[model samples]
Target: MKRAFIPPADSLIAFECAARHLSFTRAAEELHLTQGAVSKQVRQLEDRLGVELFRRVRQRIVLTDAGRLYLHDIRGALENMTAATRQVMSYAGSADVLNLAVLPTFGTRWLAPRLAGFQKRFPDAGLNLSVRLQPFDFDEEPFDGAIHHGDPVWAGAIAERLFDEEVIPVASRAFRDRHDIRDPADLVRVPRLQLATRPLAWRQWFEHVGVETDAAFQGARFEQFVMISEAAIHNMGAALIPRFFVEAELASGRLVQLFDISLDQNTAYYFVYPEGRTMRPVVKTFRQWLMEEARTARTNREAMLPR
Candidate 1:
């Protein structure tokens, strides 16, 4: 089957722009062409299609039925093509990746639950997360931002306070039964599970209650809060855990607090970004979303606490 060759691509582009805008002058302005040049291109396009694309009147122009239908279809196709092109370009530039670092326990027990909202808000952005054991060189790891626990004082980074971490002693039902823990002093008799990240937790809590214990350093050491809490749940020993992290387990009888004693750690969790890069669009967006998530987590944890 033989067919006539198509005309210049610019003519179809001119026709689509003019038909969509319903004004050759406006389309020409957008296309960086004069009105006369735009009109000529559209006319050439119509001639090739063997149809009138616009009906000219005294002071204005309008589309015929065929022109209206063609505009609707071609405008959609052009918009779709433009969007796809931009997406590909963005990927090529590596501008679509959001690299994040977070503490392992907080990432699982706290941050993981609230991430769907982040996904909903930034559907086009790719989120990549890494577990951070301690504050490190952000440039060395190539991280866009990180969640850290401490005094919002990460060196060479902009820190936004996210939440306060307060620890309270908790034990399994059996652990409490085996050791009579009516007062904070009784903690000395129970085997305490310790977090390697915060070595002085027991000392801080005991000092708050005016109790002293040499056994604070004697216990099973875990690198993460989740492991410490899980070990406590299995009746391995008592653990001083962030009250917020184990609220569900406490309410469901999976774990129980040995006493009402709670101590506020001097340090807190923060959202940290490169010192001079906090104002970047993607970093700003992720910071706002993460803060909102932290607020929600704090609210829920507060609601679950026993008064």
Candidate 2:
């Protein structure tokens, strides 16, 4: 019969703390144990595993290759355990918990403002929000669902369309005045801010507007729309930003729309969840409520548009 191997919880905890801090003394301080005791625990763990998990060079402790791999798994396990404990405690208290991942800027600008409605409707349901700037494996993470942008392309999940996205060129009023940019063709003369993920955004915008320029591929690149918006507001450059994300800046006159042209890149935001997983009651209710909210938003936006 094969024997199952499980390290003592205390030893694993000691090792994890030691690995994270790279100093037994710091780990001991955090764990409320003596430095010698922490060192003893780590030594015992290494002896049992028959490996040197750390090496001391010039009195500085550094992790070995094995220690680095072990630390990664231990951290993941600890996080899972913590999440499980929270979920069980919530269940025992008769509360519903929904773990959701969201795009940072979208969550802040749009969903956050509307969260009060969801809270009012289901006060007992606790919504745990985490920022996920990009798509990740649904099976690997503990997330119940995610609010995704770009496309409904996440594998192993059912994507519910939230809204279609429309992007327009925006810049600080000072930049426009300084550049004297009166037409779409004049955009090529100034620097353009780019989103790292959407590398060809400027090119696509120019193509849609039937204007050609080599500067489409030039300018500073950023990872998120928030950064791009900030750059635009500071007159760093013109940026192609999603309309909804920059509404506040536009309203406040911090940013000016350089052209009336908008680009539809055939991508939209989605609320996605694992396809085969059973939906928790809170998740189901939230999904229905979110869909209804999207519908209402679309209607209101269309109503405001000139005929």
Candidate 3:
């Protein structure tokens, strides 16, 4: 049997710190160890690997070619180890903890309000929510599952479709009154608020509504939908936002739909997790509850819609 190669933890930590700072003294200060102690640890690591990891240049030090490569791999490994340790410890202390990642605006505007029902259903389960704007490797991130947007293209994961997104252009009632946006063509003349994730959103909306304009691509871009929505509400510009995200604002008449047109998004929101993995009891419970809640929400919305 081939023996596993496990480098000394202390030596690896010292080397990582020293490599990051590029100075033994700074690494020592940060690690609360003497400079000599840190240097000795690095030296021990180099001897074990039979490689000189650093090049001394007078008063300073820098990583050698080999050191740079080693640092890249070691840093990832260490981060994974730290995350694993935290995960294990959290599970030990609270077995019901469910680590979930979600988009910022979706979490705040939609999911958060409905989470109380989830809590009520699964009172014993502990839920942790963190913001993740884009897709990521499930192995690298500490999340057990994520609320994902876009295509179900996440490799090695099971993506359960939650709901499709219908987006529409909205502006503050004051802005609408000011611009007199009676026709979709009038929207073309106004400043548009863009979300960074959907750069071509306005163009798509315009095309769907059969309005061709150069202004489709012209707009102030924002990273989050919330920012764009705020800009619209404050009369900065008309924003294309998911209908569900701005339900409250629309209901309160803070913003008005520029047109009755709704564009069906190519991508949708999903509840995703690593494939072929045994789900924790808490996760299973949450998954079932979330699906039921989504169905209930869709039913309620359908009933309220003009039939």
Which model scores highest in TM-score?
2
TM-score, one value per model = 0.65, 0.87, 0.80
Model 2 earns a TM-score of 0.87
Off by over 4 Å in 1: 1-95, 278-281, 299-307
lDDT of 1 at 80: 76
lDDT of 2 at 37: 93
What lDDT tens digits, residue by residue, belong to model 2 across residues 1-307?
A: 2333667888889999999999999999999999999999999999988989999888779999999999999889988888788766765544688789999889888898889998888888887788997788988987899999877888899998989988999999999999999999989889999999999899999899899887788999998899999999999999999888898899999999998888986889999999999998899889988999899988876786678
What candidate 3 gets wrong by more than 4 Å, as runs, is: 1-5, 101-104, 128-161, 173-180, 196-200, 233-235, 251-254, 272-280
Candidate structures ordered by TM-score, highest first: 2, 3, 1
Q: Residue 291 error for model 2, in Å?
A: 1.5
For model 1, residues 26-136, the per-residue Cα lDDT tens digits are: 999999999999999988888888999899988788999889988887778678778657544555544576778988888898888778887777766766677886898
Q: Report the error of model 1 at residue 181, Å.
A: 2.6
Q: In model 2, which runs have C-alpha deviations exceeding 4 angstroms?
A: 1-3, 55-69, 72-76, 79-94, 133-137
The sequence of per-residue lDDT tens digits that candidate 3 reaches over residues 76-166 is 9999899778666765645488899999999999999999988887776677788987788888777789999989979889999988888
Candidates 1 and 3: which is better by lDDT? 3
Give the range of the ten consecutive residues with the poorest summed lDDT in model 2: 1-10
